[model samples]
Target: MEKYTHLGVYGVLVRDDHILLIQKARGPHKGKWDLPGGSIEFGEEPELTLQREFIEETGLAPITGNIRTAVSYTIIYQYDVNQMEELHHIGIIYDVELLDDQAVLRTDGDGQDSLGAKWIPLETLGLLPLTPFVEMIMEPAVQEESDVGMGTEVEG
Candidate 1:
């Protein structure tokens, strides 16, 4: 059986009551809403990867700060329908912030992987077609707010 491992880094940009998200245009999660980040290049630091990805996907620079690694997880999926190749995806999630709140959307650079980036309301996240990783990452945050009865008020 063919097998491969894909390592990716993602940024979570929460501002006000919204979170930045990209509508994937390619890959296994195409057509789904996901965080604005992508695969880590060889010899690249995870932090740099997150920053580069943010610029590539959203056309906005990430505000330099204490980028915190929030979580890491793995997902398994079929890479090939006929060859039985399995893809093991390892994801790193980071909490990040953008330099500007009103950055206009751009479709250049690595944005080809996605339709575009936009701010999604946190309250309506449950209604979007999100990738499994995004859904998993947001669950705790949602639960925490509900547990405290504070509602969704995402803050940077």
Candidate 2:
């Protein structure tokens, strides 16, 4: 039998010349910089889930741009307080743009949901350590925002 897996949705919200990222205040990569996104519901569309997750996690409502890439990444994440170590997920990352920066910020969950969000310079993205898959998908596109298109080359 195959190991159980979890599906996730992520939006890369960029605004005011900065990208919005959530600080992982708990679990796996705690305190890591990454796009604002989360798991998609059973009957939810990936794009719709992205919009909701972005707002819930970052307090920023955004219009998702073309998919930057669909990346498969592995993580042995521990869920629940028991730390039994059974949960695993391959995250899906997407490209997102914020329509406005004048939005409000609110904490999402009680603990470890990484309710903290911030807008950081686009050029500083390379300075932070991220999941290998995220780094791989974002590197080139970060430098060429104007090049992204339905007709442009993208990886899945």
Candidate 3:
């Protein structure tokens, strides 16, 4: 068996009580909901990767603010029927505000990885099949904000 480690940066775009999510069109989590992000290109900074990916997946440029490393985990994905690779995913969840809240779902530009983007109510996330990392980080991210009594407020 061969193993591979994949490093990805993700954004947690929250507005009101809804979070922006993309429906995966390919890869291990195809057909599942996932954060707006992807694997970082070689020599690309994680922050840049987050920015690029957010736009690519959502079709809206993210007004990024305080970015923090949210969570890291390793999972085995069987890309082929008999081939499993260890994916070490490092998620850098950014506080992002969209330039246009009314931006409709787009598959143009670099948004091919996802079928489309939608704002889903945070509470109803469980109803969707979310990527493992998104599922793992959602609770703590929400809890952390609630704990501070600071709801979604994007800086700049």
TM-score of each: 0.79, 0.69, 0.79
lDDT of each: 0.75, 0.66, 0.76
Model 2 CA lDDT for position 71: 66
Candidate 2 per-residue lDDT over residues 73-141, each given as its tens digit: 555555555554544566667777656657675545325456477777766778886655557666765
Cα lDDT tens digits for candidate 1, 1-156: 666777788888787768888999976677899988888889999889888888788887745435554544444545456555456666788777667767666654354787888888887899999987789788877666565566555554
lDDT of 3 by residue, 20-101 (tens): 8888888878899988888889999888887788767777764564675567777777878878777676676677767665
RMSD after CA superposition, every candidate: 3.6, 5.8, 4.7
Clashes of 2: 0
> Which one wins by lDDT: 1 or 2?
1
Model 3 ranges with Cα > 4 A deviation: 100-111, 141-156
Q: What order do candidates take by lDDT, descending?
A: 3, 1, 2
* TM-score of structure candidate 1: 0.79
Name the regions of candidate 1 deviating beyond 4 angstroms. Answer: 65-81, 107-111, 147-156
Q: Residue 84 in candidate 1 has what lDDT?
A: 50
